[model samples]
Target: MSAPLLEVRDLHKSYQLKGRPALEILHGIDLQLPAGECRPICGRSGAGKSTLLHILGGLENPDRGEILWKGESTRGWDRSRWAIWRRKAVGFVFQSYHLIPELTVEENIRLPAMLAGVPLEESWEDLLDEVGMTLRRDHLPAELSGGEQQRVAVARALVLEPELILADEPTGNLDGASASAVLDLLVKMVRQRQKSLLLVTHDETVAGRVGTPLRIADGRLAGNRS
Candidate 1:
């Protein structure tokens, strides 16, 4: 059988506090994400949801575990190798919109491609339209509403056409209407592009709106709900 798109086995992470023992975050997290699948890790604040997501996305390292990409272990990869993989295969959508204040909306969307040394293809324009931000492409992030900035963020995430998307607290700072709109746009775009999504959210409503819901508490996956 073909391997899963992504998998983790016995994942563990801990943070060292000053003059104290390490505080464990993830306790042997095991997960498998199939190609084109969407999964949500639901947890309260400080429940280790974000840690797991960051580790899975290669932004952080786990103290003990195997992060497998298509059955190949990433344990031996160097920083440059991980960076290359992230650039070519992964995209991230952060809660804060993380747009460069100096860059225009279109510039922010195209930044990834430029960094990856890939050409700005015609699909770039389509992505703007998909996120309903084509008309605002020239505006700075501060000029847009919360929802509009998030729309641009979504466009930025998809601009690279990566196979995997990691979304962290995607709607933590938005109001009800704006949050709903951003979540809807994220799901629709991921589905339409046939990309895999691993979303970390504390809100149960947001979790339910995504695909399968996996609850995490006290550094472990508590349960899975359909």
Candidate 2:
């Protein structure tokens, strides 16, 4: 078997709160994700699921531990290096649909590729079509529906074709129909691209759709079930 596409070892993170002992959010998280696997992290509110996702995506630093991308240690990398890694190797989807209101759907989808210096013409049309937003490609975030905005975010996340996609509560704000539609699109895209996915969600039914669900509690990975 080949090495995992992403690996986390002994991961730890904490923050100091005013007049209190440091609050440790994650404690020695160890996980390995092979290429093309869609894994869900399920937990109750305040279980540190988002923090772990941020750490894994290089958005936040771990006080202790290591993250290896394709077997390369990410420790001690500066902000610029981390930024490049994020642009080149990771994509993030958030429940809030973090699309810039000023940018059109096509522009939003092209931003990451542009940051990575990928030519605009290379992925614009294909990505828009893939997310079924080609017809709405010229629309701004505010003009789109919740599901449409999220779909644009999904397209943007895939524009760079990163090895791993990290999503935090991706369907949190949508109605049941919209949620199911968006989730289905996300799963289909991930599978078709053969990219690894680690999603943080509260819905057990949604979690069951992934390859496996890993539960987190008390700052630790509790259990993994198929």
Candidate 3:
């Protein structure tokens, strides 16, 4: 059998206060994500859902544990190494569309590829078309609707063709129809590309639409292996 695309073992993270005991956020999280699979992590606010996503995407570090990519451990990897890997292997989408207000749609989507020193070839156009943003290519984030801006963010996330995508509350800011549309597009794109997805969401309906639904409570995966 093929190895899983991503693995987490005994993952733990804590925040130390200035003069108090450390606050534990994650408690020995163990997970496995196969290629071409989508996993929706559902939990209440402050349940460490976003923390797990951030750690997996290299935006933050775990206090103790191991994260393996295709069987290679990320232990002891320096910040620069993590940055390089994130650029090439992981894509992150936030609830708030993090597009540059000044940059046009095309520029926003091309930013990752540009940072990675990749050429702006057919892939750019292809992504714009894929996200249905071809006509909005020249518009700024301020000029687009919430759903449209999120679509641009999604395009930007995929610009690098990363193997793993970590999305945190991707539809938190949109109405029902727009949220559904954006999420459907996200799932379609990731599945068609065979990329692994770990999405953090609070809405049960949203969680149910994704592949596997995992619940997190008190910093531990509920009703599943911890």
Off by over 4 Å in 1: none
Model 1 reaches what TM-score against the true structure? 0.97
- The TM-scores, one per candidate, come to 0.97, 0.95, 0.96
Per TM-score, the best of the predicted structures is 1
Q: Model 3, residue 177: displacement in angstroms?
A: 0.3
In the range 1-226, model 1's lDDT, one tens digit per residue, is 8998999999999999999999999888888888899899899999998789889888898999899999999999999999999998998998998999999999999999988888988979999998888888899988999889988889998888899999999999899999999999999999989999999999999988997799888787856634
Model 2 sits at a Cα RMSD from the real structure of 1.4
Cα lDDT listed for each candidate: 0.90, 0.88, 0.90
Compute the lDDT of residue 191 as modeled in candidate 2: 94
Off by over 4 Å in 2: 121-123
- Put down candidate 3 lDDT per residue, 34-137, tens digits, no spaces: 88789899998888998999899888889889999888898978999999999999888899989999999999999998888978678679989989989889
Clashing pairs in 3: none
State the lDDT of candidate 2 residue by residue for 1-226, as single tens digits.
7778998898998999999999988988888888889999999888898999988878888999999888888886889999988888888999999999999988899888777887766656887888899999899999999999999999989887888999999999899999999999999999999998999998888887765788888788866544
